[model samples]
Target: MRRSPFTTLGGSGFDGSQDAEARLRWFEHVMRRDMDAPVRRLSRMVSGEVEDVIACDVVNPDHIDVEFDSIGGLESIKQALYELVILPMRRPELFSHGKLLGPQKGVLLYGPPGTGKTMLAKAIAKESGAVFINVRISNLMSKWFGDAQKLVAAVFSLAHKLQPAIIFIDEVDSFLGQRKTSDHEALTNMKTEFMALWDGFTTDQNARVMVLAATNRPSELDEAILRRLPQAFEIGFPDRKERAEILKVILSGEKVEDNIDYDRIASLCDGYTGSDLFELCKKAAYFPIRDLLNDEKSGKPSKEPRPLSESDLEKVIATSKKTQVAANEYNSLRSQLVGLSRQTETDDYPVQAAISELSKLVVSQILNLQAENQDS
Candidate 1:
């Protein structure tokens, strides 16, 4: 008595009359029925209105190439992520005993720019084996009045359907900044709806969805948003040893001279971020090529560029100057953070810790600047 799936497509299926898109949709609908329960659940969760938008942000674990080991430093942060986020999703049974042991609903990774926050998020997506929703502000915004809220609602709904999902938002402070009276009503509603859904997911102990956000400006986040993100990790700049390690990672597999002293390079490139170090390496690598081009321009015989040497790196480092934070700029940021820390009513441990770290970094930079000035 059962009818064929092809028959349900109306008329003769695969007759070439239907458009390619329509036929593909029909085929997908038919194939989804036989998929595993989780896939079926995910399919059912995406409503027609938000399906296209949500689908664009869904990142498959296999496609993500980043891994924890690939990141040069931040061992502590990696371990914390494993304990708080990865372990729970990988083995839920261990956390099922009580609500206290359950994974955090939201986590915030905050620190200076170029501190590998985005890289860490990618590593989590790859290592956790969870569905990663790389949310972007553009993806949630809509020109229509009510559509924006619906998009925000759909994000959580889709995330719930895909349990063990990580909804990562890079530069989260921009999207969920401090609520202000001058803000547009639509933007305000979107933030409120986002928080409502976030809280809703927290009540479901069995739900494995997590909101993983990274921000350079933690103080700009709203109070309620901060409350939701209880587990905050500061991805500060790498120390001397870490900088050496980062250098090794950056120069790995490259043609380099045996006399290249990474320790000397690390010591010389003080206060350079991982990104800045990478840029330094890139410029050093170009030294050999620049020579080769010069040789070609003249009547000299063409030859392969020599391997990168310590002098090459040192030359680039000598020319490259790290941008120092201006006194006024530093003071403005420090005052804002000092004000934020003075709020005695709220438990602002994260903000306080960030301020402490910022002070150390600034002091170090000032000393380095003074030393450079004396040398000059």
Candidate 2:
């Protein structure tokens, strides 16, 4: 008589070794068959699913309008995204000499934390009216090995179906980083397979998929993945002028004193990332409100809502500036990028290098800028 599955899986009957062997084999099969299959494709039908369902939570599809809320300080990136990708995408007929529209050259956005990389992406999608799919690795990354790559492939397949789609993969270095194909190598192979699929999508004429990846740790990404993305932009921290603009946006409609020196406030926030600026501004706004409320007693105060004083605002700006660590850390990041940026092979190398060098100089000049801000 043949042994039943009960006996095969039973620890007592198999002496543990046999059961272990069976379990390992079963795991291998499950991982190979199910995990390696297209998880993304199984859900979507002949039509397509909703794009916003996968978009980043912070980025809303409805707010895809320029409400004077433009991204601060990265004019060049904005222009490039518009000129190279947006215009071409909108009017493919102009570039009919077979030069190919944006869907071909994927974009890479790299910079320090809180530097508006994600914001910039949303702005692009808004400006272009493109379907934005925010690819989250953690969401697709299954407990079973090699599942994530299948999901990635499915995402591209979906992107093809949804033409003029912007696939924004944030912190992309995690999946496309240097492959570790040694012992725990399943994920590496999966990523490679996904990459191949991404490459294959280049040919699908109907697939107007524009890939945008962002990472703070650009050095960690594999060269193969980097090369695939020809249009790369660095989303560095806001400079003095940008910090001021960012503050203006964040502090909008707030009761800032008329005499409150915004130029000084912007100058002092040297090295602050875009997120940092927001944080600083938020902090500045919060304290005054708190004070106004706390000062109120049983009797109504002289002012129903206390008008924020210049001194109050100055104090807030000073405290907020102290909180920003980006100014101090910018130089180190700049050094590391300059070293790696040399590998970026393109005809615009000289221009890019010059711009990068100038940006680095600006970082140091921030203190002087800050000083002038103080004197003003």
Candidate 3:
């Protein structure tokens, strides 16, 4: 006869009370041997579920094709990120002295649209060799109630598992904006949960996780969110020199004439953003192709199109207008704000009202410019 596996538990055969007792003993023995099996299985199930939900958002540093060198201008911003984010993450031992010296839990990158804020975040991910979780608002939302909160929790849990991770939220103002009473319950709960997890990470001195957010309208963010992001950098428009450098970088890979005056092109691009410069270059590049097509259509034997010339860039510049907030107008408004503050101290000229009026005017002008750009 075949022997039963439970025979080791003092079982002789399937007979009577002794056999029942032996079975009981065998059950207890098995439980003792694998007591933690269920717990381990539960933990793995939860982890696998979280991974399934957010696996698409996780990005390895090696896959991020951006580098700090590829980004033009913003040298100061790059240096700041290198020191504050990359260095600490790369050499945590150097920053393990105290809570104050530990890596920042949250960093905000605020600027106008197309100022390379997102690009900078990617460069940081690439340079720091940290896992980048590109958190989108859609990823957290769920049709089922209470799931949003769980998803939010999952984000932090995943980030914790993948230590030395950067959770990058582009246009974060839309995600964690100033909370209103009319806000959806799910959204409010998700935001609360997100902030709570963000604060929780700070208690662990060794955790290299960081929340990196970018927005054009920082003022729209909730006060609590801003408080968590103590380290904020303003990525404003590039200056004339920076614009020239940007043009050079954009055209570096293009077939362009050596005599193309980048300085003049930059000057013409006055209030243009980095994105605007790239579009300008893109439009100019087509000129050569257009000429080649014309030559072919006319039955003229053309070996190849001529290299992009200064006149080609000039033509594009003449037609293209700056789509960003006018630098001069922005500077003027800033000066007025400063002057208003000074006047508040010296002369009581209804400073608050004047400041409010100036703020409104700035907003209206920006809106009008946006509308004009969209229309064009």
Model number with the top lDDT: 1
**Cα TM-score of candidate 2:** 0.67
Tens-digit lDDT track of model 2 for 130-174: 656677666565677766665666677666654566778889888
- The collision pairs in model 3 are none
Candidates' C-alpha lDDT: 0.79, 0.63, 0.78
lDDT of 1 by residue, 196-253 (tens): 9999888888788999999999999999999999999999878888888899988988
Error of 2 at 101 (Å): 4.7
Model 3: lDDT to the true structure: 0.78
Compare candidates 1 and 2 on TM-score and give the better one: 1
lDDT by residue (tens digit), candidate 3, 1-376 = 5332222112323333434345445434433554442222223323444444553466657656799988889888889889999999999999999777889889999988888899889999989988788887887888999888888888888777766789999999899999999998988899999999999988999899999999999999999999999999999889898999999888887788998778887888888888888888898999999999999999999878899999998888876657664555566666766666665554556866677677768756875686577536
Candidate 3, 208: how far from true, in Å? 1.0
lDDT of 1: 0.79
